[model samples]
Target: MQFLYGVQLLIMILMPLIQMVMKAIGIGFVSYLGSNLIIDQAMNYIVSQMSGAGAVVQQILGLAKIDVAINIYFSAITTRMVLSGLNKLQDRKRAQVWRAPGGTSIEA
Candidate 1:
């Protein structure tokens, strides 16, 4: 019916837009968590462990004086992971279909 066709057309038009929005939201959320939660937890753990190293090591190496940039490091790692996953998914979705000699179709 015309109603069914209209509904299908609407879905076809909106599906890609919806998927793009979801992907963007997912990436942004991951970046936020990586920059905030992961970095904070890592910094806290490092500080606790460093504090336990005693005054002798602290005075010798000056660990307290050195600043650790965990946000930058963790952000780079999270970006690389998300990009790699997205690339793999894209490649899978665009995989090539070929016909074999036996007249069977295969996706590679």
Candidate 2:
């Protein structure tokens, strides 16, 4: 982490890998802050599409709840980013399992 914070060394060594980590970090922050309005809306739409999501959202939203408008703002941001992180983690795990006998794919 320290190595990447220095621009000169980062471009040569850590740039490629760091880009993804940076993106995940950004998405996480964006979803956390509810700053990414369109993304949050899209997430709500997707969740609503799911069969059990309506009831689940309702149940979760009902108890120990904050204000309606505030809840919408908070929920929109958090749910999407959390889902995105989970999806990425699942994909990474799948890739790990699919690797060849030697572990890594290339001669790095």
lDDT of 1 by residue, 1-108 (tens): 999999999999999999999999998788678667866788788767877877898675464454344546666877887788789879988957655655465545
Superposed Cα deviation of residue 29, candidate 1 (Å): 0.8
Minimal lDDT window, size 10, model 1: 63-72
The CA lDDT at 66 in model 2 is: 31
Who wins the lDDT comparison?
A: 1
The residue pairs found clashing in candidate 1 are none
TM-scores vs. true structure, each candidate: 0.45, 0.29
Best by TM-score: 1
